[model samples]
Target chain A: MTGTELKNVKVLAANIRIDILKMLEKRGYGHLGGSLSIADLMAVLYGKQLRYDAKNPDWDERDMIVLSKGHAGPGWYCALANCGFFDKEWLYTLNEGGTRLPSHPDRTKTPGVDMTTGSLGQGTSTACGMAQGLKLKGSEQYVYLIVGDGELNEGQCWEAFQYIAAKKLNNCIVIIDDNKKQLDGYTKDILNPFSYEEKMKAFGFDTQVVPGNDVEAIDEAINRAKAVKDSAVCIILDNIKGSGVKYAEELMANHSVKFNTEEMVNKNHAAIAELEAFVKGAE
Target chain B: MFTLDHERKMGKRELRITVADAVNELMDADKSVLFLESDLAGASGSGKIQKAHPEQYIQVGIAEANMMGMAAGLSAVGFKPYTHTFGPFATRRVFDQVFLSGAYAHNTINIFGSDPGFTVGPNGGTHTTWEDVALMRTIPGAVVCDAADDVQLTWIVKEFAKSEGIHYVRANRKAVRNVYAEGSTFEMGKGNIVKEGKDVLVIAAGQLVSDALDCAEKLEAEGISVEVVDMFCIKPLDKELIIKEAAGKKAVVTFENHSVIGGLGSAVAETLLEAGVSVKFKRHGVEDRFGQVGTADFLQKEFKLTSADLENTIKGVLL
Candidate 1:
């Protein structure tokens, strides 16, 4: 990748992190854990990798992205708003009644969303279908899908993974946000999806593991996968939930924590301030 | 001895031949038009289309859910995909995929749910989908169509090809009476009034339209002038016509080869209630029960989904 492009991805990743913080701060409570984990990846995709036009979100030739772990849509909504798919002002409306930006990304309502996916593993299967369809039509556009590591426990995801590899959909890229924690608790204690990389590879995908927060490494892997032809590639991103915010990261119950107390609100604000300073210093 | 034109023009034998022919024609014209089957191509008589257009046809090997997802994916990238399976599998087996990927996502797909109701005959209750219409109608934005005969099937196939969004066209493999003449046009959500009467209105859908017409003829002998309506589109129903007919009629009888709960009967009831038409009504269908293995004729008799049953229901309501 070019130096300029690499620099752009880094900046975009940081911006996405900031966007996530701002959105969470506005909501006062949301799925910060999973959403923060995939922020950098979303930055890399929306910022540098994905070939999509914000002006024409419905462009037939545009690359498709399906957020299988749709609960992390706060991060995606932030990414979409930053990328100009819709106004950034709409980010505060997340999960509110009558808001186009629902808790889950709805394709009909959202500007850049390709499919409405909230039902765990169903999105991955839908992404596989989109990729296969692109291949059948001989379209060069690719399909990028993000699934939560914990969400892989869903049988539908494996079913989709099998089909994607079986079809040899080279135009598809699957990124699993390995945040370890699910709704109730950690993934290992609940239902361990032992080794995602090995499992995907066995299912015939060209699999790789990367630090989800490292935008450069994720971009390089995606570039390498894009270079390959006639093979499905999966990148299992090892990430910590609420990586950017120190307090949110430390708190176990912050997966969908509501900032009810003044102290909790102050802690969230402090985390956002720290992230902003870190991003400004990096620039 | 069946000529291609003769088969196409005829109503009873038309459904099997015309659908297969239309699919073949679509394949020839647009390379993007694809047909996916779930091991029932031979039974549905779509094997010829598959053979001639092998590249356009996908045999998914009995995995109905997988086929549904695959079809959705194909549609995502501009391919107009049509999936064929028996009514039971099409409506119930992979309902979630059909609901999300096809209907909810607004994918351009047409599902040919063949062997609806007692049409599967010897294949029995396991294969016959008495509740397919009810199941399909519940899906939002899903257009459910049951063609009366082959003529309507041919027209529906042609129209479906040009139309966009999710459409479920229920077809019976069994032969039935042809009602429409050649060049007769039918819209997606409009009902066709076959025989007009002032006494009562008989609203029916699918193969039951034939039975409704027959009931109308029988009812005429008893001095009850019953109007027969072919309520083809179950979802986005022809409310205006239904209300207009129901308002003037003494009573209304709804006949369908599906469950009375969410099928044509329910739709008619909802429409009538909304319009505030206080007409006495009787519903003749599968009375909230699962079907058993039997011949098509036998099952129809067992389920009371015949002209005689419909006439009796109408007469009983009148009494």
Candidate 2:
């Protein structure tokens, strides 16, 4: 990716972080770690990589994507809103009663959410099925999945991995956000996954590990994955628990942030202000 | 199960074979028909269709939950996918996915669960599922049907092809008696009255439908009148016919191959309660208990699921 393209993605990712903060602040409490961790990848994919029509969200020829860790729903909704799928004002109504944006990504409720997901490990399997169905119908469409490191603890994810490999669902790409933390604590302290790449390799995936926070790196990794046909690819993203925000990263416990307290509200505003300043400086 | 006396005496085809053949016809006719198997296609007889058309068949190998989510994903993309597995795994193994991913996600898919209740001989408690109907029907907007014969089964498969939303059809793995004629068509949310009598309303589903009819036959010989209703469509419970036909009868007797707690009996009981109709009801089937391995006959006799049991149970209700 060119420097200008990389810079453009960086600006989009920073804006998405602000969107996440705004939504969570309005809702008073929501998943912050997982959503923030995937902002860069979301920016690259939604900003440049994906082939979707904002007007026709169900366009047949477009590539389909599933956010396996659906707690990151706010991040995805922000990406869609910014991309003109809907107005940005909808982000404030998230998690409210009768809101289109629920706590999780629901395809029936949200316009651009291809599949409903919140239950861990299930979305990856659905992605596999979607890719297989498209392949069977002889469509050149691709199915991309983004799963969290904590979410891989679900046996169904591995079940999907084995099935995709066995069925040779080459049209699918599974990106694992190795954020190294779950809702409880650090993933290593909770339940050690050891290495997702080696496990995915053992499960017969064309494995690749890249810096998850780098938009340019993820773009290149996806391009590389696109070239490898006849097999599914698993790209591991080594990102922080809270990628762009220093307060959440310092506390290391912002898995679900509630800005109800004075300290938390101040910290959130400062973080959003920092992101906005970064975007302005880039310009 | 195939249906009707004329078709019955003419060397009837296996019930599962009818499902496979109907699905095969569907695959040939519609490009959107996709089938997912959890390594039981051969056992369920869908393997025949899988062999003829590999493009539409997907074997997820023993991962039933993944098959459900996969089917949900396929449904999102406009493919009308049907997932097949043994009875217990179909509902018990992936109940949450069927609810959240299949139903809540607004994705439409069909699930065919074979070998319900004691009919899964030798595979034992782990394989036989008496709770499938209860669990399946409980899902909001789920179309739950317990198809008694191939005529109903074929109609259901075709109906689901053009229909929308989640559907679950549970039928026997092998042939049983035929209740309906060969070319009979069925609409969803309607009940089929096989025999008409005024003394009692006898409602039944699955393998027990034939037995329920036998009990009704024996009661008729003793100069007692009985009405038989084949409630294939369990959900959208056909309350209109259940009330209309069951009017002024001394009682309604529900017999099923599933547990009496939440299967056909529970549905009928709820209907009777809501309509505020005072009808003495007798619930017969597997009581709240786990299943065991034995021939269908042995399990039926042991579990007190025989026509004789139905006869005694109905007699008790009549008095």
Most DockQ-accurate candidate:
2
Off by over 4 Å in 2: B1-3, B6-11
| CA-only RMSD, every prediction | 3.4, 1.6
The DockQ of predicted model 2 stands at: 0.83
Model 1 interface RMSD, one decimal? 1.7
For TM-score, the strongest prediction is 2
Docking level for model 2: high
B-chain TM-score, candidate 2? 0.96
Give the per-residue Cα lDDT of candidate 2 at B290: 93
DockQ agreement of candidate 1 with the native complex: 0.49
The runs of at least 3 residues in candidate 1 whose Cα sits more than 4 Å from the true structure, single-residue gaps closed, are A1-7, A59-61, B1-17
lDDT of 1 by residue, B134-252 (tens): 88888888888988877778778878888778889998865667777666778888988888899999999886777787788877988999998888888779999999888778899
The TM-score obtained by model 2 is: 0.98
Please name the candidate that would achieve the greatest lDDT relative to the true structure: 2
